[model samples]
Target: MTQRSTADRAVGGLGPWLPIVLGMLTIFGPISVDIYLPSLPALRDDLAVTPALAQLTLTACLVGLALGQLLVGPLSDRFGRRRPLLVGLGVYVVAAVLCSVSISIEMLIVARVVQGVAGATGMVIAQASGRDRLDGPRLTRYYANIAVVVGSAALVGPLLGGQLAAFMDWRGIFLVLAGIGTAIWLACLTGFSESLPHDRRRAGESSILHDMRSLARDRAFVTPVLVIGLLNGAVIGYVSGASFLLQGAYGLTPQQYSYVIAAGAVTFVLGGIVAGQVGARRSPRALLPVGIGLAIAGATATLVIGVLDVGLAALIAAILAVTSGTALTVPSATTIALARRPDIAGSAAAVVGVTRYALGAAAAPLVGLGGGLSAVPLAIVMLVCTLGALGAWLAIPRAGEGASGD
Candidate 1:
């Protein structure tokens, strides 16, 4: 008989239903964020807010996600991943319902912030759980599973939101999401098991500042973290600005925009799957350059198309290319960041999580910097971010030390 590895047992023990449970929990944040996207126009009219103001709802959600992960990342390190997940889900359910009943854009923004905060708990906890149990390619596979489901939800969410907005009301989308959150939370209660054992936890310090200092000292850890953030920042730039680009520039309807966004989003999952395969064969360092190269090429193409007025097909192609490149890099980079430092997996994950969304938040405003949709401005922003990521990866010393615990 072949000797079973810890990773093999962990993967095998996941069983049929467990992936579904894990997938649902991990996807909640994206679902909550993207679902409202189709309703942006409708919400603007209903709540009597400007398009810029309506966009703030999304900004608030992104900020909340950053803050929530910031706190939960360390908390999960202290208490195992499960309890924080449970409490976070409970908060998410409440926030979702509150969003459904929100009377104004201000109320909606506040609720979205709450939902983001709560939803973030799910993402960070799920990440911590995976790090606790697996490493290298095995961990890559676990994250790939998450990327597929959550990304699929993001792909489908806008379409669903548009249809629901057309038939029922924009508020109905949140109501449905709340119900889904409740169901997912209930399922997690029975199906999930704690991965971080008591013996594995550290005894002294364990403070947020301490974790930050430790992560800062590690060159290998920080390089990948910056890459993850920049790559995600590019994606978020597209997401926040896509509506204007598709509807205004390309003359597409909400339904059409949904399809276009979904197409790009699906490739994100495909990239994640490909990254998992590549990770199994090589170190993340070997793969990072390839992924960033794709990103630079795609962003360059998008800029040319935007500047030359190359029409919708070219625009869509550019979007898909950049998104796919981003998908490939994100998980591999994240796995690298957490691969060392298993003891502070939560802290590592938290730092990475914050960097990811904080950069995303920054990208949102930068994507809008031209004061209108134009090719050169968006392209420049993306290139700046992607190049910065590439530079950071190169700057970090690759040969230094042994891998730390995740």
Candidate 2:
């Protein structure tokens, strides 16, 4: 018989295909949101809905992704990771199918919400799993690797979405999403063992309130979560405004805009890898301030360039710095927060997920204010967010710079 070695047998270390599968799960929300963006006009026309009504589909997904983490995280704590994740994947598949078959905008919108919730399940569980099994440098490294994987997903989702739209209608994209969910569900059945054993399980909803209070009281936990969330707010603002900044002002085509964003994402991926390596040698905290400094400089440049209407090259360089800097900060902050409360990893990861999405949604609209004809507003949003993140980082406890940030 073959040796039955896998993620289950590996403790305190990620096994083969572990990060890959988790990366795939982590991309669920991104794929759901980005893969169908090109088909919005077609979907709107087919469902006979106004542009604003059609846009609600996107809003529904973001809201669901944010709030659903609140539900999934605690459940995983109560019942172990395996069953909840499997159930979530099943629901996601069903929701995607429902989305694909919807005849009205309302139906599609509801289905998309369900899809987002299901996506959140995988996302939170992946982070919880990392915290459950790993610690120290390994913990931070896994998260950095996840950042790289997610960057690749973000870069590819739009390109794939644009291509899929050329060949078929919007429904086909949902089918593809369903297909992706199904494959991941199958992988889960085989690859995952209960990381949070029954003995460690807490009462799901009953104790969640207590857990939240405890997490809120800890400065080490709260500060890092703020850093992660605020940096993500800056990122979402950059993403929301980039198209307008590039396509509207510079007159770049959609394809060209994508290419420019893809370049930034490549830098993001490289930054994550470099951060992970440095974190392995030092602690995640060792490089945290460096990341913040880069982000501040980049955001400052972006704000100035937007006001001055500097050359496209300078603007792209500034944006890329922001992208790479954010990448460096995220995994470290995630590790610090998660490493603080391994016992309630699910709840902790849940809070982080919720903050990121909620703040991201709040920041997104700022990019479009005043007709969004200029990049000044988006640059301002980014600058404020990065500065906020820096302030939060400074508030973190100063005693754990050499350790796992516990």
Candidate 3:
């Protein structure tokens, strides 16, 4: 019989704490983005920039996140997860401080890009580490738990940011983020052990291009990656545009918008819990159609409501549906994609991360391009993205064929 790997041993030794720790690490992206959202209007005025330029700050971060994952994922595959993670967290702390002190919109945009690059390390490694230890049904459940943590952070980050913005200025928010990054850095230094052992590490000379080619040829992997990208695009597009829609167009305050966004986030948590329970009894593949269908329904409702000029109640219900669908879809799709090649989990996780963030970066700007005041543009873009996700899901083979089709 084969002996257990370090990751397997760590899973047994750490028990419940392992997933929690990974979840905390993975939340860096959401917290960083969401916490700054309430300040976007203030930041735009303070920096004396155009609305489009202000939106670029957010777009720049998404682009950096996508590019950073592409670099760090392959490195983690060869060098192990711990050192790169620690270094990235350190950079994140410094970049947050830079953002706090930025004197102009250009400076703030550049700082956000660097901050996102550093934060991507945590996002990529956390998922890669999960893939290191778990597989099959267990992997699906682990991802569900991670989704709950992410959802909780999404719920809290904006509310806290709005409160902070009310109490102080936007600069205080970045200072708080700096403090958070510093704490996470120390935790990683002291508490986290290297999950990928030397024996399992990819050979130094292995070609990343070859790995990309291999993954591209695998329809199972490609389909899920596309679906993940499109779903995330819809979610982030909502996030990017919601502040302007609610606060600028609908005349809601930042505090009120935060409460609305937080309420919507709760549905995401509910969906995650439901997916966790359902995934155990059914194949993860079976969950895909239901998830995509809900997303389509939600997006369609949002478009219709926006065109009709309905009030916030109708809009909130539609947004809740979309977020819940994502909660159901992302974990299941991620588990299927990452399980395809356990040895190259980091690379696989990176591909998914890059695609998701890249599309999200594209979607953020589209919401503002048609004019920042209307929710109609945001609704339309989300509808298109959800439909794209559904199309990608359909491209995969039937449920019993296996996610990887190996």
lDDT of each: 0.79, 0.86, 0.85
Cα shift from native, residue 198, model 3 (Å): 1.5
The residue-by-residue lDDT of candidate 2 on 177-207, one tens digit each, is: 9999999999888776677766567864558
**Order of the predicted models by lDDT, top scorer first:** 2, 3, 1
Over 4 Å off, model 2:
1-13, 204-206, 400-406
Cα lDDT for residue 79, model 2? 88
User: For residue 361, what is the lDDT in candidate 2?
Assistant: 81
> What is candidate 3's lDDT per residue for 1-406, written digit by digit as tens?
0223456774353455556667779888889988888788898898888888987887788777887898888889999988899999999999999999999888988999999999999999999988887776777887888788888998888778878898878888899999999988888787677888788888978888877777877887889888889998999899888888889988998678877878767877888888888888778887888888998899999988988888888988988788889889988999888877678888999999999878887898899976767778988999999999999998876656655423
Q: For model 1, which pairs clash?
A: 340-404, 340-405, 341-404, 341-405, 341-406, 342-405, 342-406
- Poorly placed runs, candidate 3 (over 4 Å): 1-7, 10-16, 40-55, 102-107, 166-169, 247-253, 307-311, 368-376, 398-406
In candidate 1, residue 219 scores what lDDT? Answer: 77
Return the TM-score for each candidate structure: 0.89, 0.94, 0.88
Per-residue lDDT over 139-244 for candidate 1, one digit per residue giving the tens place of the 0 to 100 score: 7777766767777888777777667778767788889889988998998888777766666665556678878888887777888899989988888888878777
Query: CA lDDT of 300 in candidate 1?
Result: 89
RMSD of 2: 3.9
Query: RMSDs, each prediction?
Result: 3.4, 3.9, 3.1
